[model samples]
Target: MYRYDEFDETIVRERVKQFRGQVARRLSGELTEEQFKPLRLMNGLYLQLHAYMLRVAIPYGVLSSRQLRRLAHVARRYDKGYGHFTTRQNIQYNWPALVDVPDILDALADVEMHAIQTSGNCIRNVTSDQYAGAAADEVEDPRPWCEIIRQWSTFHPEFSYLPRKFKIAVTASPHDRAAVKVHDIGLILKKGEGGKTGFEVIVGGGLGRTPYIGHTIRDFLPKEHILSYLEAIMRVYNLNGRRDNLFKSRIKILVNTEGPENFRDQVEAEWEKIRDCDIDIPREEIERIKRYFAPPAFEALPGESASFEAARARDAGFDRWVRVNVVAHKVPGYAIANVSLKEPGRPPGDATAEQMEAVADLGERFSFDEIRVTHEQNLCLPHVRKDDLYAVYQALKEAGLAAANVGLASDIIACPGLDYCDLANARSIPIAQALAERFAASGEEEDLGELKINISGCINACGHHHIGHIGILGVDKKGEEFYQITLGGSGAEDASLGEIAGRGLSSSEVVDAVERLARFYKRERREGERFLDAYRRLGHDAFKGAIYADA
Candidate 1:
């Protein structure tokens, strides 16, 4: 993890002091709601349906055990006893008093963390593959680049207030765990000719009322010139992106309107100018940042853990967990273990303070005192010894954090819809809960095989419903909640936006509709076919007919 230097520390503390005064004035009635809106948003505070929500950034989703512990402390002290981990790999406190925000910010700063750029129309927290350094198939760790971008973008005067919010993601692995294709700017690290590292830059990808899978603007951009290229893209968007209509403000809209070829031409033209300036990070600084993410010291051990194998042979539940939650690590005898936040009947992506602390402790004891927040709203111990798997599993079980449902139907991604958000049309949590319970009780989630079910309260796509295998969008029909379903969407290397299956179903009918679709897939799928693969093969008509067969 990147530790804060004096410069980083100074700016964070200074920002906290400035925001403290801003908050006090608002509390004293010196600032009206309208006046305080931007100020509060600048500091990552949102006035939600019931209370103020504070979103704290976990940069590139990397956290030290110490930082995780600090977050647990904040959750316990300021707001409710839990916090919701978001798709952006940040955490949200749904119930915080307005006055205590500064204190929360201070606590976060104490651990080299902050809420800066977590919101607003600026480049939000740069997300990446949660298993960046640890993944077996990675060409290079993308976090150092993520950190470089963070240092470059934070409080950048030229790009601070874009036409709309911007998002950027990086991935080095071919599997696309970072969902880079759905970001405003996506970078895929790869080796070019002469084995030199560079990025394949993709632009204009986003999801909201309108969604796009992004277009590859540059086949290969030298890694050294990443910032220059990014600046060029930002400059193009800032100059021509729509300012008159909020709906048309995003860079995706501009890219689509102008066409990818013209947009790429403009960016290339801008890059020719900016690339010669002093925008790129020097090699020395790049090496310095890379040191912060070097692999941990490892003990020499055989690839297979005898204890892990024996335990798996003995315990069915533990074996099931190992099948889904554990993944291949780059180093021998190490594994990347996912801690699922999606327990049955629970709101997806939420963790109690206790659970957070427990995972922190587990990471310290078993992994290398490091944890990662996934784009899927889960925590990961990026470097756990295979020999210690059972002990870690037992501890997670005791903490109620052991749900062997990674990538399953129950492992849903849902936003805080009408239950918390003022912009929401219907409740998202209950719908997620109902569906998760349905899957769990039937013991069909494992059988369904690697399905994604995402729900959003509105068209904003906060839950990333546009990319789920079964995407559910909540709609208001005559002031009543109706859930719309989209099928075959994926946010992977083969990224594609889902298609709506037809009319929206009432909240009461949505779960059964999903069940019907699942049944149809199970009955019709080829051997070993996942839900996504089957859906793609069977086409929309198959599932659409199944869901509406009983309608």
Candidate 2:
């Protein structure tokens, strides 16, 4: 919700102007594909299998109704009639023409949005909890800090081209909904001594060919020095991170090779050098950023809504939806409603233009003119009145946006695998669709409580499969698609990379394999254990046996 200041506006407009010229040159044959590769990447454009893809940044996953409408417009006019919301909380247009990209950038600039830093080797979109300011458990809102980092890192010449792409995420809540531990840099906000808020910085956490749960480099860094401290971390990585092998270029590889103790020492030494510099953030600017994220004017009302309670009593389907999709808000008489994009039998994260428009209208009418894109590939209305729940449900239900699977098995996270990406070894969307249908048909989706199934087309880990409770990675065996399963992975506060269970399953066999494993988990779990917990206690061998026992 941070409106662009005049300075921000100028920066975006200038960026658009620069990209427009670059795009014109490429179209006119003045620039070859090789020459334009980095230029296009710098602007978040990619050459996929079938056509060019444009990824637009939704900063910290916050969107105004106006921005949402702009995205809908882009889908309607520029590409196919839909866009894919990615695991990074950004949206992708899979079939945009190269000539139309500048126009898209200009349109985004008009709405105070941009594709800058959504791709390339520089820091990617700085993400945070979708429930940031609204969640009851938050220590403080993290978006202002994210905005500060965005201001500092965007077009920062020093970090323009690193050895590999960088990503940062912040989570104010202890729950770690932002998958902070799996990012290149993860900031966990907490109240330190003397009631001062600070960050517990985690570095070297990322998932790709090599996976890591970032090590804690600093236990407590005061909020005032966040930028300076981040500068130190980047300086250390830039100075010594690998450049010889593309596969070994990420900060996680560097940290693992150097060892966490040595890496920590390097970061601390760099911090000491720059901590007292003029990089200290201004109090007034910090206050200004904070003001944009202050809670919406919520009316004072009683804790319960009579109509909502009555409706729940009357409609079992709606009651089930409320149980799964609705989350508690900090304010009384308000709730956070998560709109599921992972409807059964559809590809995960694909939102049609019409559905996007429907969400935009619902946000404007019922949720204070704002919508949030969840890292789980869903949309959230962060400030819905409890009294309007049924009407909101009806609106969403009619628009094909009302699936009540939030943390359930049906809410899958999948990348556009071989279907879109050139780097993919296999297809991911069909696997997700198959599993969704399998679960729905068996009536097993609702029975499996709080499961996360993440699928990646390749080891690039764009699907974040490494952190799912059940992780599925597509691998190619002599040009055939096969899925390798991993269990016990989680992206929460207790973040861990999933362990590979056993041999790969054919695409035809993967869905039934997943159901078999789920039934196994249900039978083996202790009374209070979730999938990850059950896996930890029961061990991988037991689950592996479950998958192959009946095969």
Candidate 3:
């Protein structure tokens, strides 16, 4: 993880002090609610449906054991006993007193964390593949670049108040685990012709009311020019992106209106002037940032651990957890273990204070004292030893953090919908819960096979429903909650936005509709076909007919 330097510390401390004064002025009745809105939002505070929600940034989704422990402390001390991990790999506390926000920020600052840029129209937290350094297929760790972008984008005068929020995601591997295609700006790190590293830059991708896969603006951006190129894109959007209409304010709208070719041309014209300016990335700085993410010390061990095998054979639950939760690591003896937050009926991506502390302890004891928050809204111990897998699994299970449902149908990705979010028109968590329980009860999860069901309370697509194998979007119709389903979207190398099936379903009918769609896929799929593959083969009509047949 990137440690905060004196400059970083000073900036955050000053920002907290400023926000404290702002809060005081508001409380003193000097500032009205309208006057205080932007100030609170800039500090990552939101006045939600019931209470103030504080979104704390876990930069690039990396956390030290100590940092995780502090988060647990904050959750227990202020607001509720749990915090929800979001799709962007940040965590949100849904209930917090307005007066206690500064204290919360201070507590976060104590661990070198903050809520800065977690919200607002400026660049939000720069996310990346959760398994960045640990993934076996990675060409390079993407966190350092994410960190660089984070610093550059934080409080950037030019982009501080954009037309809308901006997002950036980077991935070193060919696989798009970070959902780069759905970001405002997506960078894929790859090797150049002479074995030099560079980025494949894509811009204008977003999901909201108008979902779009990013277009490739630069096929190969040199490593030294990343910041400069990003500046060009931001400048283009800042100057011409829609400002009159909130719904069309995103860069995606601008890109759509102007066409990608013209947008790319404008960016290139801007880049020609500022390409070698102050934003040019220095090699030494890159190396310095990279040093923080170097692999931890490891001892060479046998490919398979005998004791681990013994525990797996003896414990059926442990075996299931190991099979689903653990992933391949770059190092042979190490594995990336996903600590699932999606357990049966609980809110998806939520971890209790105790569970968070337990995970922190487990990371320190069995892994490398480091943790990651995946884009799928799960926590990860990215450098666990394969030899200690069973021990870790047992510890996680005891903490109510062991769910063997990674990438499974029941492991749904959901946003804090009407339950918390003010922008939401209908509830997403309840629908997610109902569907998860339905699938678990029907024994359809195992048969569904690697299905992703993502739900967003609204069109903002915070839950990334646009890219799920089965996407559900909640809308309000005449003050009633309704859900519309989409099928066949993916966020990988062959990324595609899902197509809506047909008429929306009422909240009562949603779970049944999803069940019917799943059964249709299962029955129609050829041997060894995943839901997505089958959807691609048969198209949305097959599933649409099954869902709307009796309507």
Best-matching candidate per lDDT: 1
What shift in Å separates residue 312 of candidate 3 from its native position after superposition?
Answer: 1.9
**What is the alpha-carbon lDDT of model 2 when measured against the actual structure?**
0.92
Tell me the whole-model lDDT of each prediction, alpha carbons only.
0.93, 0.92, 0.89
Between prediction 1 and prediction 3, the one with superior lDDT is 1
Model 2 C-alpha lDDT per residue in residues 315-407, reported as the tens digit of each score: 988898899999999999999999999999898999999999999999999999989999999999999999998999999999998888999
List candidate 2 stretches off by more than 4 Å. none
Candidate 1 TM-score to native? 0.99
Candidate 1 lDDT at 427 equals 86
Instruction: Report the error of model 3 at residue 95, Å.
Output: 1.1
Q: Report how far off residue 451 is in candidate 3 (Å).
A: 0.5
| Residue 212 in model 2: lDDT | 92
- Predict model 1's lDDT versus the native: 0.93
Better of 2 and 3 by TM-score: 2
- Candidate 1's residue-wise lDDT over 1-551, tens digit each? 78888999999999999999999898899999999999888778898988999999998999998999999999999978899999998999999998789999999999999999888899999999999999999999999999999999999999988999999999998999999999999999998999998999999999999999999999999999999999999999999999999999999999999999999999999999889899998999999999998888977878999999999999999999999899998888999999999998889999999999999999999999999999999999999999999999999999999999999999999999999999999889999999999998898778888999999999998989999999999999999999999999999998999999999999899999999989999999999998889989989998899999887
- In Å, residue 11's CA in model 1 sits off its true spot by 1.2
